[model samples]
Target: METEPLLLSTSDGVATVVINRPARKNAVTQAMWVDLAARANILSADPDVRVIVLRGMGDDFSAGADIGEFDTLRGDATSARAYEATNSAAFAALRNCTVPVIAAIRGICFGGGFGLAAACDLRIATADAQFAVPAARLGLAYPQDAMGDIVWAAGPQMARYLTYTAGRIDARAALSAGFLLEIVEAERFDARIGEIARTIAENAPLSVRASRAAIRAALSHDAEEAALAQAAGDATFLSDDYAEGRAAFAARRTPMFKGR
Candidate 1:
């Protein structure tokens, strides 16, 4: 079956976002980025989806933005800004989702692809996965807001290293550089991702949401960050799922969570 540039599918509380332009290594066009933002909005509003996963349709995750359209779409400052806005919005959407976002990477993930993966809450890669940031070579500037994802994922030093060198790094280097959470063999990658998605899907949504907030708080530097984090954690304690969790533990059975 031929896949669209991007595809969103939800099943059993898990939503998958697929970048499907494998003919060009999943190179995303401006339209695809807009669609990604729209899909992120849809996934966030969907209560049935407790988690979101991003992946590629074929071997390579993505080669980043489709440069073939650059002559027209990014030829001028106005068009360039507008074009980049779609990318920024897509990344922001992924970051803003309260539900955890996981990036399942298999092959080439560079430039914009690397940025998106860095924006995800978690990244799982296959042994063949490779990453790079080619802005330096192309004489382009990486925007400050978008830079946060790379900075947060790999630290300011590594971010600078990757950008300055513009060198491609394999899964082992990416993981060693703290860009990926786990790396599985290519043969077992799909199964491992499925297992992880199922485990997250089976958990209490309330707890998951609360935990996401708490983890995000670690990234905040605002004066009230502590208060906000505490409030979020406190709210979960009063949730119906919390009661169900206690009861289920007492009864020695699985608890059903409704995301309330």
Candidate 2:
């Protein structure tokens, strides 16, 4: 059976979201953005999902939004705003996922594609991957939410440089600028990401969620977010997983987390 442009699959507490439009270099269309948001939101609410890995099919991660649609979808201020809404919604879904979202990027990751990677909690890329934001060159502006993610990932200085210059940076440069967690050789990339995902999945779910929430709260410095993070952390202590964790530690066996 054929898959949609964006595909979601789950196994062993991990959900993998794939950008399936390899022919278009996985450049996302407006409809794909909507699908992405829906799928991500669903995954966020799924108790069985411990982590999410977002990646593109074939050689490239993504070249960014489908510019061919710009004439009809973003031709005017009103239409552009609408188009951006979908894009931001997709990014927000990934950003707000309860579990960590890792971007497994390869080859070209540019423009909105870069924003997508930024929205992820961590990014693992192939050594040959390239990153850029060509909004200026295209005479376009990134959505505010997307811009926030880019700035958060790259820091203000690096974000400014990329946006202003519209130049491409190699994987090493991206890693140095904080946009990537690490770069793996093309041959080992899939295996490395799978290992990382499985490692995360083996941990106590509540603990992972709490850590993510706490970190987000710390970074955002929002009172409400802090409260939410505190609540998540507090919940872990009362969870059955906590008991199992302690028991397994005492028994010197791996703890089997149930996400309770």
Q: In terms of TM-score, which candidate is strongest?
A: 2
Worst lDDT run of 10 residues, candidate 1, spans: 220-229
Q: Lowest summed lDDT over 10 consecutive residues: which window, candidate 2? A: 1-10
Clashing residue pairs, candidate 1? none
Residue 30, candidate 2: how far off, in angstroms? 0.2
Instruction: Estimate, for each residue in 1-260, the C-alpha lDDT of model 2 and write its tens digit.
Output: 12688887899998999999988989999999998999999999999999999999999999999999999999999999999999999999999999999999999999989989999999999988999999999898988878889999989999999999999999999999988899999899999999999999999999999999999999889999999999999999999999999999999998888999
C-alpha lDDT values of all predictions: 0.88, 0.93
List ranges where model 1 is wrong by over 4 Å. 1-3, 224-227
For model 2, what is the alpha-carbon lDDT of residue 217? Answer: 96
User: What is candidate 1's lDDT per residue for 15-75, written digit by digit as tens?
Assistant: 9999988889998898899999899988988899999999998899889988898899988
Off by over 4 Å in 2: 1-3
